[model samples]
Target: MRVISGTARGKRLQAPRGTDTRPITDMIKEALFNVLGSGIGGASLLDLFAGSGSVGIEALSRGARQVVFIDNSHNAVRVIRDNLNNCGFTQGFELYRNDVFRAVEILARRKTKFDYIYADPPFTVEAIFGPLLETLDRTSLLAPDGSLIIRSPRRMILPLKLKSLQEYRVNNYGESTLHYYRLI
Candidate 1:
C-alpha cells in the first residue's frame, strides 16, 4: 500500500506478510480523506486496531499533528514502524502493541483526547463493537467536536447512538462500511 497525499504522497508502505490483518484499500482511503478534507490538518489522531498503521500514517502524511497507532499483533507493529520510517515520518506518532480495549482504558487514564479516532476491528468478532463504542463514550477520549470513524462489514449493524456520541454518517464501500460519529 501507499500514502495517497501530503508529505508522504505516493510513498509505498509494507504490510504484514500474512493474513493476520486487513489493510484498508486505496480507494476507500482516498474517499475517507476526501470526506475529511482540511479537517485532518493539525489534528491529533488515534488509530485503534491499526494493523499496518496505514490509516494513521495516512493521517500523518496529510498533516495530522499527532497520531497514536494501536494494534495487538507484533508483526503489525513492526510493519507499522517500518512504514513510518519508510515515509520519513520519524516524529509525531506513537505505536502501542496492545488490545484495543486495554489501549482505550490506558489512554483514558492518561487523559488523552484525539481530534480524530479510527477503528477497524475484525469483521467476524462482532461482540466487541458495542462495548467499544460504549467505552469510548464512557471515557472522554474523543474531543467534543472531534470525530470517530469505524470500518466494519457493510451488513453489520452498529449502534445509532451512544451515551455521549451519535452516528451522523455512514458510507458504504462495497463490502465494507464507514460509520462516522460525533459527540452529542
Candidate 2:
C-alpha cells in the first residue's frame, strides 16, 4: 500500500501478511479525499479496525491534525507502526492494539470525540454494525456533527433508523464496496 497524498504522498506502506486488511485502492482514496474536501484540515480522526493504518495515515497526510488507530492484531499493529514511522506520522498518531469494541469503551469513557470515524471491519462483522453503532453512541465518541464512514458490501443491510443519514453513497470496486455516510 501507499499514501494517497499530502506530506507523505506516494510513500510505500507495509501491511499484514494475510487477509486481515483490505487496503483502499488509490482511486478510491483519491475520491475519498475529494469528498472530504477541506473537512480534514486540522481535524481529529478515528480509524477503527484499522488494519494497515492506510486510511488513517492518508487522512493525516492530507492535513488531518491527529488520527487514532485501533486494531487488535499483532501483525497489523506492527505494520501500522512501521508504516507510520515510514510516513513520519508517528508524532501525530496513536496506535492502539486492542479490540475495536473495547477501545470504543475506553475512548468513550475518556470523552474522546472526533471529527471523523472510519470503520472497515471484516465482512464477517456485517451483523454487528447496529450494536457497534450503538456502542459508539453510548460512548459518545462521535461528535454530533461529525461523520461516520463504513466500508462494507453493498448487499449488507443497514438500519432504517439511520434515515437521518446525510449521505449513503456506494461505489463498487471489484468484489468490495465502499459505503460512505454523513450526519445531517
Candidate 3:
C-alpha cells in the first residue's frame, strides 16, 4: 500500500506478510480522507487495531499533529515501525503492541482525547464490535466533537446508536463498509 496524499504522498508502505493483518486499500483510504477533508490537519488520532498502521500513517501524512497506533500483533507492530521510519516520521506518533481494549483503558486513564478515532478490526472478530463501542462511549477518549470511524464487512450488523455515540453516516466500498459515529 501507499500514502494517497500530503507530504508523504506516494510513499509505498510495507504490510505484514500474512493473513492476520489486512491493510486498508488505497481506494478506500482515499474515500475515507475525502470524507474527513481538511479537518485532519493538526488533529490527534487514535488508530485501534492498527494493522500495518496504514490509516494512522495516512493521517500523519495529511498533517495530523499526533497519532497513537494500537495492535496486538508483533508482526503488525514491526511493520508499522518500519513503515513509519521509512516515511521519515520520527515524532508525533506512538505505537503500542497491546490489546486495543486495554490500550483504550490506559489512554482513558491518562485523560487522553482524540479528534478522531479509527478502528479496523478483523472482520472475523465480530464479537469485538459491541464491547469496543461501549468502552469508547464510556471512556473520555473521544473529544467532545470527535468522531469514531469503523471499518467492517458490509454484511456485519453494527449498532446504530449507543448511550453516547450515534451513527451518523455509513459508506460502502464493495464488501467493506465505513461506519461513522459521533457523540450525541
Candidate 4:
C-alpha cells in the first residue's frame, strides 16, 4: 500500500506476511483522510488494531502531532515498525504490542486523550465490535470534541448511540463501512 497524500505521498508501505492483518486500502484511506480534512494537522490520534500502521502513518504524513498504535499480533507489530522506519518517521509516534482494549484502558488511566481514534478490527471478530464501542464510550481517552472512527464490514450493524458518544456519519466503501462518532 502507498500513502495517498501529504508529505509522505506516494510512499509505499509493507504489510504483514499473512492474512491476519487487513491493511486499509489506499482508496479507503484517501476517502478517510478526505473526510478528516485539514483538521488532522497537529492532532493526536489513536490507531487501534494498527496492523501495518497504514492509517496512523497517513495521519502522521498529514501533519498529525502524534500517533499511538496498538496491536496484539507480533507480525503486525513488526510490519508496523518496519513501515514506520521505511517512511523515515523517527518520532511523534508510539507503538504498543498489546490488546486494543487494555491499551485503551491504560491510556485512559494516564489521562491521555486523542483528537481522533481509529479502529479496524478483523471482520471475523464480530464479537469485538460491541464491547469495543462500549469500552471507548466509558473511557476518557477520547477528547470531548474528538471523533471515534470505526471501520467494519458493511453488513455489520453498530450501535448508533452510546452513553456518551453518538454516531454522526456513516460512509460505505464496497464491503467496508466507516462509522464516525462524537461526544453527545
Identify the leading candidate in terms of lDDT: 4
**Residue pairs with clashing backbones, model 2:** none
lDDT of 4 by residue, 22-123 (tens): 889999999999999999999999999999999999999999999999999999999899999888899999999999999999998899999999999999
Model 1 / residue 180 / CA error / Å: 0.2
User: Which rank order by lDDT, best down to worst?
Assistant: 4, 3, 1, 2
Per-residue CA lDDT of model 2 for 39-112, tens digit only, reads 89899999998998999999999899889999999899999899988988758789999999999998987889
RMSD of 2: 2.1
Q: Write down the TM-score of every candidate.
A: 0.98, 0.89, 0.98, 0.99
In model 3, which regions exceed 4 Å deviation? none
Model 1 TM? 0.98
> Is candidate 3 or 4 superior in lDDT?
4
lDDT of 1 by residue, 1-184 (tens): 8999999999998888887688999999999999889999999999999998999999999999999999999999999999999999989999999999999999999999999999999877888788888888899899978999999999999999988999999999999999999999
List the pairs of residues colliding in candidate 3.
none
Clashing pairs in 4: none
Instruction: Please list all clashing residue pairs in model 1, or write none if there are none.
Output: none
Model 3: worst 10 consecutive residues (lDDT sum): 121-130
